[model samples]
Target chain A: MMRWTLKSLGTQIASTLASAGGVAGAFLFVLFLEAVFLGESKQIVAYIEHMEPDIWVMQHGVSNMHMASSFVWDWKLDAVVEMDGVEKVTSILYVNTMVRAGDRDWFTYVVGLVEGDKRAGPWAMKSGSASPGPGEIVIPALFAESSGAGLGSSVSVADKKFTVVGLSLGTFSMANSVAFVSFGDLVNILSAGGTVSYGLVDLEPGSDAAAMARRIEAEVEKVSALPHPEFVRNDFNMAMRMGVDVVAFMRVIGSALAVAIIAFTALVQVSRRRRELAIAKALGVTNRSIYFSVVLQTVLITTAGYAVALALALGVAPMISLFVPEVTLLVSTGSLLRMGAVALVVAVIAAMVPAYMVNQVDPLTAFQG
Target chain B: MASSKLIRADGVSKHFGTGHTQVRAVDGVSLKIGYGELVLIMGPSGSGKTTLLSMLGGLLRPTQGRIEVAGTEITVMKEAELPDVRARLVGFVFQSFNLMEALTVEENILFPAQLIPGGIAAARPRARELIERLNLRERRDSLPKTLSGGEKQRVAIARALINEPPLILADEPTGNLDSRTGQEVMMILFDITRDENRSVVLVTHDPRVEEIADRILWLEDGKLRDRKSEDHSWVRDPVCGMRIDEWTAVHTWERSDSKYVFCSARCKERFVEAPDQYVNA
Candidate 1:
């Protein structure tokens, strides 16, 4: 029986792969896109590690990075630091700056962290040293690679020349590339000598984050205290609002197409095997056995097809990454399990229609000349 | 009395369609086939011989009346239970052979036996025995499509005997074979019935089959007439010496003071030319 099942699986693989190449191609493409865009490569949480702030304080009406605007007075940090349960508070400046490396210039978000604060500065520096002195800068790896500039190289941003002193691991954000700079330097760049963009607050161990946020919001009326949880939620919301969820959409479409392909294949197979099924029924095979065999055949086929697709996807991952530099194909155990579950569901649904046909087959007609 | 008849049908009528358009396929068949009897049902086309066989085999339910095969009234059995009854008591061979093309000869033979109440482990030896008895062991693993007409018919016979059912229902089991092959198949079927004490109800339009039957039933227009019981009423052709029934022969002759008959014109001519020489000299 296993040999027969294997033969059936082989036939199913050949037939489905021959006729429904588009579905398989599309499924692999979706997996490739997921690896590149939404997978570990686009680490939103990792970028936030540089701030190291237990709480963020933005303007009262600010929602996301691009959609909302906020600029609290620089003096607000002093009052925030004196609040009960406040450990320390420092000012952070964020601005979009275009840096020129060689002849080509690209846009990136220059984030300002306080000097001498290891918890809040260039957390994932890959090369060179962190805490770039007054005129030095830390560029993300993607910008450095694209701009063809490395450590000790001079780059210009906003007409201010600075030497590239280090490289960070995480590259671009969903919105833009992030470059770490000193808060004092950013103050000079944004104000030409004035207040910063937002405040970064660290709370004591026993502090209630929500209550602290409310108190901070009440105290600093001009700006709002954005909790860490809300900040993460806003980040995801912004990504969704900007149509950066292409990976998720591709996954859905791939799943639907896989189901359709399996269903159509099962239907065609059942139609072809109608006579054989009828003969089996006439020969006294019970209705239950016929149904079970049809479903078993479908599940066996789908399992084999999914295996082939997964192997092919893994083989082409590097090629996909090379062709589409922005995307990476990360085939983790979790993703494979997800794909297997999807294929199993598709197999069951696909087999149901044909199994129903088998159940309805009249055994008497099988004996007819 | 006669070991309580293996099959008993009472006023079994099967009608197709409705109202004025109703056609009675097996109008009202009431017959009993006892154990170890090979009964041949002979009729012309559209004479309802196949329908009667189907009713006897539990393949079709009679429109009205009871059918008892192997002590179970099939008419009272539910649709779900019909297959079990058929598998346990009746093994059917169709005119078309009805073998699963995808399965091998051995698999087809083992199919019915495996589906019976017991497990396949209990049925495997029986299936092997039947396969060997039918001389199909050499081609057991070969698919039905690769077998010749005669070989396929023999496989079908093996399948019918696999479960060791008390009764065998054959609908033109040799309909597609040549005369020699047909004779060989009939010989095997009759030998099985006589040797194994199994009852057989064979449905056919050909009168040549009447030779092997213990009792010959004549059906005309969905009704059974009386049984024919004349000894030596059918004879082998002198030229080829193949058994031919008197009703279907091109020429038939009867001997004086004896009801015995000879098959063809040539055989009768030869017998008449030298009466004493051919008779008893």
Candidate 2:
């Protein structure tokens, strides 16, 4: 019965195409928005999110990494490292600036990492080296791709030229392309004498990150201490609350329009085939059977639409990533599962009115008409 | 065929509305259809032929009356029970050949049988046999849109018999077909009544149906008009010449303690004013 009903409706290619388009379009729009949110959240703190820091110390009011600037006096690192829970401490500086490469200027975040300390520094490298020596910089692969910077290329920062010596992997930024500079060069550029961005403290074995963070907060004044995970979460929440919710609003609008399109298509299909349903009822076909057939057809349509939308998203994701290399359109299994559930619920809801209409169809109408 | 009543309707009246707008589509109708009887209900449009058929088939409940189909009192049966009754006992063929446009000829015939328990298993073989018997083998997979009017009607007949229903209800089964095709369809129905010993109650406006009917039942203004009064089941009024049902007659006269019903109060008054003139005439 489902096959027959679908085939009957399938003959009207124009309407079926329109319906499929509506379903697929809705799915794709929601997916795009979801991907953008994922991208924004991931890129908000890409530099420090996956660092080996157990406790992250920042200025008292700072919650996000890239959006706000936080600084601590140089002596705070000495106090934090001396805490009993601390294993090692690395002081870092976040310098948001623009770098000029020949005719093009790229907005970039230059992170200053402590010399000889791998913690809170670029650990993964695509080429050259993860650490940048004096008068050298480690550019992120996304920044290199976007700004046409390569190994040994000279990029001018504050009218001073520095050679890109390494390329880091997957350390892209939403606000700007990211690069790593040495502590000496960073101090020279920012004129730092007694100020640092924050201190990343690694906890000793079996030491709790939260406990160490509490210890640091107690000893350090004018600074806030948070566990690394909490810091990452704060960054994500800050990003969402600031502006990324617009994507969520777009998703809701897309879903409503999608529901309308699917509902209209289903209503039109059921209405057109009402005579056929009445005929089936007269032939001893139960109302449940008719309703089941309609619902089944709708599920099939929605599943097909989801499949098409997924294919389109997968096809477009890489291209989108290439265009905006700083942030990636993240597609994961969890997101796909969420999307599948929404599509199924939409399909079922859209079918309800049509199913009830089929149930109310009088069998006698078939004979009389 | 042994004579046995397959359908019994007692004082059935089906009214559509309330107050002055009430339309009595089938009023005070009593009918008994025997097995192997091909009863054709003939009436003009809006004469309640279809309405009466709908009531008998349990598709519509009567406003007042009792209907027993194959010994089951369908009138008092719950609405939920009607589908099973319709599936197991009553098979319907329609005026438009109402075959499901989505399904093919074979699926159409197999549908009624599939409604019963373990029906698909039984219906498969029955469908094959009926398809071959009805000469629809070549069109088994052809949709209703692809079949001719005669072919469609034949498929409908095959469907009606697929469940081996004891009673079949057809409403203008050949109204859309040509006269010769209509006759062929009627003959198929006649053959089912004769060979399978099934009862058929058909509603049609076509005069050609008269040839196939074992007994022609007439309906007008929602009331049954018997063609023959030999059994005195329906009495013809002396003045109006209209058949009056004794169970539902509102106007009647008593002569020597023998009751006689009149078609209307005006007819009853005219008959009482000069009973001898009309009774003798």
What TM-score do all the candidates reach, one by one? 0.76, 0.80
Query: What clash count does candidate 1 reach?
Result: 3
lDDT of model number 2 = 0.79
Q: Score chain A of each prediction against the true chain A by TM-score and list the results.
A: 0.76, 0.82
Give the fraction of reference interface contacts each candidate recovers.
Answer: 0.34, 0.58
| DockQ of candidate 1 relative to the true structure | 0.28
| Candidate 2 lDDT, A86-176, residue by residue in tens | 7887898887788776576777778887776677678689898777778888887767776777899998888878999888887766556
Q: Which ten residues in a row have the lowest lDDT in candidate 1 chain A?
A: A1-10
lDDT of 1 by residue, B1-281 (tens): 33389999999998999999999888788898999999998766678888888778777889998999878888998888877877778888877888766678887787777676675678888878888888888998998879988899898888888888899988887666656677788888899899999999997644566767988887778999875455234555543466666553434455676543343333456666776665564
Best-matching candidate per TM-score: 2
Cα interface RMSD of each candidate? 2.9, 1.9
